[model samples]
Target: MPRVTFIEPNGTEHPVEIANGYSVMEGALNNSIRGIDGDCGGNCACGTCHVYVAAEWRERTGRQSEMEHDMLEFAEGVREDSRLCCQIEMSDTLDGLVVHIADSQH
Candidate 1:
């Protein structure tokens, strides 16, 4: 398992241990972390799981796919670091991954 830290807009942090092969969105939802509304159930079709990957962990998270990029275009507060949590799969290499919940999903 890898630990992921999800920071809320209000500066609250919810860190949880996520199993390998699970998406970050699933980790948040399982832990009851707020602000990540994965409406499409971890499908890249929805951008509701939007988050900002911490700069230090961005490289490990890797770049989004073409479909993911297109979906993110509809997300609020799009940024260089913006990514749909559903697209980020957990792995041992990303043990200390940190992501900030966006202010809005739509």
Candidate 2:
């Protein structure tokens, strides 16, 4: 399992351990972390799971896919680090991943 920290819009942090093969969105939803509304059930169809990857962990998370990029266009506060958390799958190398929930997701 890998540990991921989801930071809420108000700056609160909810850190939890997620299974290696699960997506970040799934972890957040399963742990009852606020601010991530995985409305599309991690299908990447909805942009409600938007989050900002911390700079230090961005490279480990990799680049967003074209489909993800398109969906993020509809999200508020989009930035270089903005990513649809549904696309971020957990792995052993990403043990300390940190993501900030977009203000609009609140």
Candidate 3:
């Protein structure tokens, strides 16, 4: 399993192990990590799972898709590193990934 660290707006960190092929959002929801509502059930339709991919891991996480990019327009505190966790699949390369849950997600 790979691990992902979700940092909340209040600076709390929840590190959870996730199975490969699962989305980052699933890892958070399954582990009860706060701040990631995942309102769309891991689908890219909702922006509730918005997070900021750490700068160092951006390339590995890849850029947001067109749908994801468009959907993020509705999210709060959008930024260059902003991405929907639902769109980022967990994998060996993504192990130890770190993301900051958007303040609005809290």
- In order, candidate lDDTs are 0.91, 0.92, 0.92
> Tens digits of per-residue lDDT for model 3 on 1-106?
9999989899988889999999999998899988888898977998989999989999999999999999999999999999999999999999999999998877
Off by over 4 Å in 2: none
Query: What TM-score does candidate 1 get on C-alpha atoms?
Result: 0.95
lDDT of 2 by residue, 1-106 (tens): 7999999988898999999989999999999988888999998898989999988898899899999999998889999999999999999999988899999989
Instruction: Estimate the overall C-alpha local distance difference test score of candidate 1.
Output: 0.91
Comparing 1 and 2 on TM-score, the stronger one: 2
Q: Please give the distance, in angstroms, between residue 50's alpha carbon in candidate 2 and its true position after superposition.
A: 0.6
For each candidate in turn, the TM-score is: 0.95, 0.97, 0.97
lDDT tens string, model 1, 1-106? 8999999888888899999999999999999888888999987998989999978888889999999999998887999999999999999999989899998842
Worst 10 residues of 2 by lDDT: 53-62
Model 1, backbone clash pairs (residues 3+ apart or across chains), number: 0
